[model samples]
Target: MLSAYLLVSHGSRDPRPEIALQQLTELINQKQQSYSSSKKLVGLAYLETRPEPLHIQIKEFAHHAVLAGCDSLKIIPLFLLPGVHVMQEIPEEVALAQQAVGKDFNLELLPYIGSNPGLTKLLSQQMAEIITQAWVLIAHGSRRPGFQQPVETIAANIGAVAAYWSVAPSLEAQVEQLVAAGKEKIAILPYFLFAGGITDAIAQLTETLKLKFPAVTFQLAQPLGASAELADLIWDLMKE
Candidate 1:
């Protein structure tokens, strides 16, 4: 009985997230190879942008996995926050997939990638190399009331203020607050796994922020891309 692991993400139309996910998939596969045999399976799935919904994707992947001798499967959500998708949608999809897959199959939904404390530590390490008096930890925010808690917690852990891309306490607002607090050198870390349209928009916003706050210095860090370090995190998420 083989155990197959599938990394699921909020799908994108830009193609970059998909590319990064595939790279991550490869990295996880490489790590899996190191600790285990060549018999296991590692794959990628999406919650959107495909013709099929997530449950269907999970079902199809599980079907393929079973054919490849996989009896048990773990679905790991690659999300960075415990947003609506993580707290509600993904688990619902997993349950639907579990129901459809039936008795003999073992389909378990693992905790999301963002739920790991190691993630904040990784973010801290990323900022350690950059010189800044203060930091703004930004993410694509959720409309869900308590979703900002994780972002705030991570920011607090890293000695930074929190900002959201699509919600209140935006990057502009955060920068203004820092500038008002006498911070001259500030850095912004994108709390994402890869560079996407939102990251580009954040870069543009930084350019605008620089013009707005000419006296205050600003630096923007890359999102946690598909590096071995991130792969190591994903590898840790999957016990297979």
Candidate 2:
């Protein structure tokens, strides 16, 4: 049976994340072309803040794939955590799409990209290049219980502390804690997929913190952008 791939991400008006996703998709398709001749039809869908709703995108892609003789479609979420979006929203949309497309096509939802163990190695590699007394992995926190565990686990694996943009133990608080512990030089790594408004906010906050704590040193790293390693991870998820 012919197979197709659909990548879903939290859409934004900033355009950077969407552009990054497109680049990643191009990289993935290029890699897949080396091993397959089926063209491996790939499409992108967004969860929110985009012009089209996710369900509409899913249906449109399903119809296109059906016309192209595709028998199955796999969806890979480009989110960092298994929060409400991963746990409830995407699945619900998929179910609705399935009903609209009928049984002629099979739809499968893959795990979120952040759950890949290879990401820990990636984060570790990024951290190793920087010299700092302390590090904080800052993510866009979720209010749902148990959602923070993955961020915390990743932080532990990288020997860094976990901080958030929206919740408790925020970037500022984490920096304060590090300062209290006599950690003057600290690095703040944004655990995001791309550089967008939130990542820009993180940079601004770092500047503010620098002014507040004039004696301390703060370094901010770039977000995980379109990289070869990330494309490999997406391909790995597809294989699974």
Candidate 3:
């Protein structure tokens, strides 16, 4: 059966994240074309801060896929956390899109990209060159009780600590804690797929923290951008 893959990201006012998502969509399509005779159509959608509402975009993509003879559509959330957007907003939009598209199409919502185990390894690779330093995985955390678990799990896997942007144990607080714990050298890794406003904020916060803890050395690593490994991760998620 012909299939369409919709890579949905949380929309951003900053163009960088949206551009990165489009680049990633192209990468995924290229990867799909390389292996499959029946090439799957790939598209991008955003949840908010975009010109089009998510349901409308989903409907448009679904219609386009249907016209291209795709009987199935799989949506993969590019979010790193199982926040309100992932758990509630996206599914609600998908339901609306399904209603708009009718029952003839097979639509499925896949797991968030962060659920991929390979991602932790990918993240670990980013800091491989550095010597032993306390690592902190920063994410756009949700106040929702269980949302922090994935970030915590990833941090634990890498022997690091977890910090949030929107919740308690802010990035600064975490850095302070690490300093108090006598960790002089620290690495702050943004657990994000692409560079956006939040990532920018993280960078700014790191700079401020560096000034605050004059003795402690803080190095901020780049976000997981559009890479072949990341494209492979998306393909694997789609296959699953």
Candidate 4:
């Protein structure tokens, strides 16, 4: 049987994030072995930071699978949502890759991580465990209005748990709303991996808000790193 797995994520030059992806792939492979199916798992990062763009990445992986005599390839996008990159850009790239590798290569793009209600529940539970007061689930907000629904869904699903007063918004809007509401204690949970420009900007914004809402305290939680639950989620996707 010709079969292989590819776990694709947003590429980062930072070694830490890339390393985490590698770890996630290893976990997937480990789980697959329990079912007596042995297939090579490859992890690819898509961005200029990496040598391969999405097209090249998928094609190269497909070529490797073909050479290895595998007939099927499954791609799992590690993004949090089905954004423009996931919906338009990645699919187009995959189509090109499929043509380049050969029509015979069976390839599939799995759903984005954020689409899973299980993962959303986990995110909400994680936030609830950490925050005893009002907080914002900070995400990489998009100007595209369509991008907001996934975040809204996650927030609503999380709210269903009734753990704490939680809201989802761009960092700026969240901060502003919290201050206006006279909330004294607040926290921000970054919905991203790795600290970068956006996280830094949120920090700066939070500092200013702290002074303005002196009664409100702020804390930032670490981004969801590679964890067993994530590893499980990947396995669940691949099984489907």
Candidate 5:
């Protein structure tokens, strides 16, 4: 049966995230084509910054997918944390989209990107070939209870301490702890999917951290961009 896949991301004002999402959509579709007899239709949607809400976007994509002979459609959330967005908001949006999409089409919400076990391995790979006395795996953070556990789990798996961008115990705090422990070289690994305004801000903050701790060396790593390894994870999710 022919199917369609929708890669939904947290919308960004910066153009780079949309571009990267486009690339990721392409990569996933390419992977689908590689092993299937017919190409699976793929699309991108945003949770914010779009004229249409996620439900409307899903309806539109499902409309096209139905027209394109897709019997099944999967909406995959590209979120790393089990916050309100992943736990409640997005599912509610998907439910609304499902109503608009009607009954015949198989519109389903798959497990989020963060739930994929392959992510731990993928994150370890994005660390850039560097030796450091300590590693800090920082995420965008969420206020939702228990959301931070996954970040801590992934960080622990990769031998890094988890920090947040918008919440308490920020990256600076983690660095402070590391410094207090006499770690001179540290790597700041962004647990983000793409580089954009926040990553840029992180870079700027890294510079400030550098000046603040003259004796310590900090290496900022790139976000997990639209890479094939990530595509592989998404591909696996579609099947799941």
Candidate 6:
């Protein structure tokens, strides 16, 4: 049986998002306990732009797993895709960590959450519920716009399902266009976990727009938290 777990995420400069990841880790552990009490788990780190680098975090996590008598450690990257971070960065860091820890530990890397169809459906449902006029799904935009298409796809699916007036907008551009066009009611769904700086910036922008377009009501749908669907998603990943 697997004795411990480690969840690695692309850490945020905003501490609040990191705190949200910790909450998710606890939620995962709580669900895992149903299978066995012996398994122990903790969230480790990796920062795209932060103080604690990926390699250092992995070493610390390996120590925790080893000290906990873990023969096996499940490494789940809490990300959407198998992009640069997942393909190159995490694997390289994990390799270094494995060399130091030796072959006694079995390391299993689970697939990203974005690959889950169920989660995509859930996101669509959430988007449909929030928007009566139009939707601009706000994501943590990447330098590579191609990486953003999954979010657009999810938004399109929501529009298809609802048959509602919605357009997928990058947080930077279409938001202002919609406001200018007299879109009466618009919802900006932050496709993120926890309220942080991005959410704050979103609020400021929308509120400023609200002053200009008083008729347009901007509501933010909360991120998918520790919901049953998310819990089941994690459970399915563990089973794999």
Best by TM-score: 1
Q: Which 10-residue span in candidate 6 carries the lowest summed lDDT? A: 160-169
Scored against the true structure, residue 208 in model 5 reaches a CA lDDT of 98
Better of 1 and 2 by TM-score: 1
Residue-wise C-alpha lDDT for candidate 3, range 1-240, written one tens digit per residue: 677889998887888887887888888888877876767788888898878889899999998998998887899999877888888999999998989888998779999998888988898888796665799888888768788788888899988899988898888888888899899999988888888888888989888988999999888899999988899899997763
Off by over 4 Å in 3: none
TM-score of 3: 0.94
What's the TM-score of every candidate structure? 0.96, 0.95, 0.94, 0.84, 0.95, 0.79
Better of 2 and 4 by lDDT: 2
**Runs off by more than 4 Å, candidate 6:** 35-40, 48-52, 81-83, 128-131, 160-172, 176-183, 226-229
Better of 3 and 4 by lDDT: 3
Q: Which of candidates 1 and 2 reaches a greater lDDT?
A: 2
| Residue-level lDDT for 171 in candidate 2 | 93
**Clash pairs detected, candidate 6:** 184-216
* Model 2 TM: 0.95
**How do the candidates rank by lDDT, highest first?**
2, 5, 1, 3, 4, 6
> By TM-score, highest first, what's the ranking?
1, 5, 2, 3, 4, 6
Error of 3 at 119 (Å): 1.3
- lDDT by residue (1-240, candidate 4, tens digit) is 646778777776567787777777777767777764556556564744766678788888887887898887888778886777788887887787888877778788888776666787567656766654676776776666566666666666665211112334346566666667776667777777455656666778778777777777787666677777778777777663
lDDT of 2 by residue, 7-44 (tens): 99988899898889989998998888886555678899
Of 3 and 5, the candidate ahead on TM-score is 5
Using lDDT as the measure, the top candidate is 2
What lDDT score belongs to each candidate, Candidate 1 first? 0.88, 0.89, 0.87, 0.69, 0.88, 0.67
